[model samples]
Target: MTDYNAPLRDMRFVLHDVFQGPALWARLPALAERVDADTADAILEEAAKITGQLIAPLSRNGDEQGVRFEAGQISTPDGFRESWHTYREGGWVGLGGNPDYDGMGMPKMLGVLFEEMMYAADSSFSLYSALSAGSCLAIDAHASEALKAAYLPKLYSGQWAGTMCLTEPHAGTDLGLIRTRAEPQADGSYQISGSKIFITGGEQDLTENIVHLVLAKLPDAPAGAKGISLFLVPKFLPEADGSLGARNGAHCGSIEHKMGIKASATCVMNFDAATGFLVGEPNKGLAAMFTMMNYERLSIGIQGIGCAEASYQNAARYANERLQSRAASGAQAQQRIADPIIAHGDVRRMLLTMRSLTEGGRAFATYVGQQLDLARYAEDAGEREHAQRLVALLTPVAKAFFTDNGLESCVLGQQVFGGHGYIREWGQEQLVRDVRIAQIYEGTNGIQALDLLGRKVVADGGQGLAAFAAEIRAFAVDAPVHREALLEALVRLENTTRWLLAGVASDANLISATAVEYLHLFGLTAYAYMWARMAAVAQAKLAEDAEFCGAKLACAAFFFERILPRGLALEASVRAGSSSLYGMEAGQF
Candidate 1:
C-alpha cells in the first residue's frame, strides 16, 4: 500500500479556487480577522504533516492491534494515547469549536478538509477525535453556560473526551423507543440510568475523563421522541475548580468486536444513577441532541470521502507501478517485462472513476461546509436563514450520497488491484470495511433519503431545493463548455422533485420506495454543479498552471460524461413510483 498523503493540492484547489473560501471568510466577521488564505494554507500544511507523518502510520497497527476491553476498562492501540495527545496539542480538537472556550475557532469549510485528511490517514484513530468534536458542538450549542464553561474547555483541549450516548440495545434509528430514564433531583441535577450501546469512544484510556451527552426519557415526560431529554453525564464528576473528581455511575459494560475500525472502542455504557445535568429545556432533548446529530452526520459523511480518498491514492499508485500486460496501443515500457496496469483502459477507467468521484466529493463536501459556515457566521440575517435552509436541505444528501458514493468508490479502488484487493494486507479491503459503517450509522442513508425527499423537498414545498437549483442555473449561464450538461441535470432534478412531490401525497409508500433514487438524482445534480464550478475556475486559470488546471478540467469532463449519466437511471427509477416496490407481502421472500 502507498503511504497516505494529504492531497493538499486538490484540497487547496477546492478551497481557494472553487469555493473562494478566502473571500467568503472575509465577508464573515467571525472568520475575517482570524482566518485568511495564508492562515488557512498554513493550517492545511501543518495538518498535512501531522496526518501524513504521525497519524497515517498508526492506521494499519490500529486495525491489526484493534482494542482490548477487560474489567470495564478499554485500551486503545499502542500508539493511540500518545497520538491523541499530539493531535490535541495541535489544537485540532477545537478547529471549528467556539472561540469563547479557548477553541481556535476555525471555519467549518477548513475544518471539513482537515477532517478528511485525518480520516484518510487513519479512520479508526480519527473516530476518537471526531466524536469529541461532535460532542463539543452539542455542548456549545445547547448546554447551559455553566455546562459549557465546565466541559467545553476540557473537551476542546482533549483533557477530557466526549461521547454521544443515544443508541440502546433495543433502539437504533427509532430513538423514540429508547428505554433509558433520567430522573430529576432536588439540586437541578438528574440521575441518569441507561444502557447505551455502540458508543464510540465511550470508555477509553485516551483521556482523563469522558463526558457523555446522553438521551433518556424523563419521569414526567410525555411519550415518543418528545419525551426524551438530554443530559451531560461525566465519567468523573468535575470539581468546582474544573478538575476531575470522583467517578460517576457510568462504566463500560463491554466493548463490541466490530467488523472494522477495530481500534476505536465501541462500548456498552451502563449508567446507574449517574450524576447528570440537563442540557436544554426538559422534554426537548431530541432537539438539543440534533445539534450533535447534524454535526456528526456531516462528519460521518466526510468519513466516507476520507476513506475513498485513501483507497484511491493507494490504488492509483498501484496501477501506475504494478506490471501486468502491454498497453492496448502497444508496449509503452519496452524496458520493463510488461507495461504497468495503468496502461490498460479498464484500469484507467477505475482510477478515473475513483479520482473523479473522490475529487468531486471533496468539492461537494467543502460546499456544504461553506453553507454551514455561512449559516453560523454570516452577518446578515437573511443570508444566515438562507444558508441554514440550504444546510438543512443538503445535510442529509451530503451524509447519504457522499458515504454511498464513498463506499462505491472504495470498492472500485479495490477492483483496480484485482485479486490482491480482496486481501487484507493491501489495506483496500480494510477501507471497504471501515467506510461501510458510515452509511449504516449516523442515521442510515435510507433515513437520510426520506429526510431529503419527504421533509426537505415535499414538506417545504421545494423552496430550499429551488434556491439550490437557481444557484446551479446561474453557474450554468456562465459555464460556457459545461452549460448544456449542467442545465440538463438541473432540469432532471427539478422535474424529479416535482414528480415526487405530486405523487408522494397520494401514495404513502411512494416516498419510501423512491426517496433513495431521488436523493441519488439530487446528489448527482449537485456534484455536476460542483464540477461545472470547478471547470469554470480551472478554465480561467489554465494559462497560468497548465498541469493542475488541466487536470481539474479533465476530471470535470469525466464527471459530466461518465458519472453524471447515472442520474438518468436514478431519475427513471424515481419516476417509476412505488407500485412495484410494495407488491410483495410480509415474509413473501
Candidate 2:
C-alpha cells in the first residue's frame, strides 16, 4: 500500500488559482483580519505534514485494533489517545471554530481541504475530530452564552469532545419517531432519558469529556419532529470552576463492530436521566440540529473524496509497478518482459476516471465552501441570503454526489489493482470499506437527493436550482474552453428540474422514486460547470505553469468528454417517472 499524501498542489490550485479564495476571504470582514494567502498556504503545508506524517501511519494498525470496550469504557486503538492529545493541543479541533473562543477562525474553504486530507489519511481518526468540530459549530450557533463559554474553550482546545445523539434503535431517518424524553427540572436543567444507537465518537478515550448533543421531547411538547429539542448532555459534568465534577448518567452501553471505520467507535449510548441543558429554543431543536447539519454533511461528503484519493494513490502506484502483458500498442519498455499495467488502455481509463471525478469533486467542494464563507461572513444581507440558498441547494449534492462518485472512484481504483486489491494488507479493500459509510451516513445519499429535489428545488419552485444554473451560464459566457458542453449540460439540468418540480405535486412519490437519478443528473451538470470554470483558469495561466495548467485542462477535458455525458442517462431516468418503481406490490416477486 502506498502512503497517503495530501494533494496540496491541486488544493492550492483550486483555492487560490481557480476560485480566488484569498480574494473572497479578504472581502469577508470576519476572515480578513484572520487569514491571508500566505497564512492559508502555511496552514495547508502544516496540515499536509501532520496528516501525512502523524495520522496516516496509524490507519492500518487502528483498523486491526479497532476500539476496545471493556466493562462499559470504550478505548480507542493504540496511538489514538496520544494522537488526539497532540491534535487537540494544536488547536486543530477548532480550526474553523468561533474566533471569540480562541479558535483559529479559518474559513470552510480551508477546512474542507484539511478534512479531505484527514479523512484520506485515516477516516477512523478523522471521525473523532470531525464530530468535535461539528458539535462546536452547533453549540456556537445555537447554544447560550454560558453553555458556549463552559464548553467551547475545552472543545476547541481538544480537552473535551462532542457527539450528536439523534438515532435510536427504532429511529434512524425518522426523527419524528424518536421516544427520548427531556423533562425540565427546578435547577433550570433537564433530565434526559434515552437510548441512542449508531452514535459516532460517543464514548472514546480521546478526550477528557464528551458533550452529547441529544434530541428529545419536552413534557408539554407536541408530537413529531417539530417538538424535538436539542440538549447538551455531558458524560462528565464540570464544576463552576470548569473542572470535571460528578459523572453524568450518560453511559456507553456498547460499541458496534462495523465493516469499515472499525477504529472509530460506533456506540449505543444510554442516557439514564442524564442532566442536560437545552441548546436552542424549546420545540425548535430540530431546527437547531439542522443548523450544523450542513457542516456535518459537507464533512462527511469529503470523507468520500479522501478515501477515493487514498485508493487512487495506491492504485496509481501499483499500476506503474505491477508488470503485465505488453500494451496492445506494443512494448513501451524494451528492458522488461512486460510493461506496467499503466500502459494498458483499460487501466489508464480507470485511473483517469478516478482522477477526474476526485479532482472535480474537490473543486465543487471548495465552491460550496466559498458559499458557506459568504453565507456566514458576507457584509451584505442579500449576498448572505443568496449564499445560504446556494448552500441549501448544493449541500446535498456535495454530500451525495461526492460520496456516490467517491465509491465509484474507489471501486475503479480497486479494479485497477485486479486481484491484489481484494487483499486486506493492500489497503484498497479498506478504502472501499471505509468510504461505503459516507453514502449511508450523514442522512444517506438517497435522503440527501430527496432533500435536494423535493425541499431545495421543488419546494421553492426550482428558484434555487434556477439561480445555480444562471451562475453556471454566467461563468460559461466567459469560459475559455468547453463552454458549449457546459451549457448543454446546464440546459439538460434545467429541463429535468422543470419536469421534477412540475410532476412532484401530482405524483406524490415522484421525488422518492426518482430523486437519485435527479441528483445524479444535477451532479453531472454541476461537475461540468466546475470543469468549465477550472478550464478557463487553467487556460489563462497556461503560460505561467504549462505542466500544471496542462494537467488541469486535461482533467477538465476528461470530465467533459469522458464523464459528464452520463447526465443524459440520468435525465432520462428522472423523466421516466416513478411509475415502474412503484408498479410492483410489496408481496410481488
Tell me the number of clashing residue pairs for each predicted model.
0, 0
- Would you list the C-alpha lDDT of every candidate in the order shown? 0.91, 0.92
TM-score per model over all chains: 0.99, 0.99
Q: Kindly list the per-residue Cα lDDT of model 2 for residues 137-228, writing each as its tens digit.
A: 99999999999999999999999998989998888999999999999999999999989999999999888899999999998889898889
The residue-by-residue lDDT of candidate 1 on 1-589, one tens digit each, is 5689999998999999889999999988889989999999999999999999999999888999999988888889899999988988988998888889999999999999999998899888888899999999888988889999989999999989999999998889889999999888999899999899999999999999999999999988988998989999999999999988999999999998999999999999999999999999999999999999999999999998999999999998898899997998999999999999999999888888888888888999999999999999998999999999999999999999889988998999999988999998789999999999999888999999999998999998899999998888777776867899989999989988888778877899998999999999999898888888888989999999999999888988998999999999999998888888778987996
Model 2 lDDT, full chain set: 0.92
Off by over 4 Å in 2: none
TM-score of 1: 0.99
Residue 279 lDDT, candidate 2, scale 0-100:
95
| TM-score, candidate number 2 | 0.99
- Candidate 1 displacement at residue 426 in angstroms: 1.8
Q: Could you tell me the lDDT of residue 105 within candidate 2?
A: 92
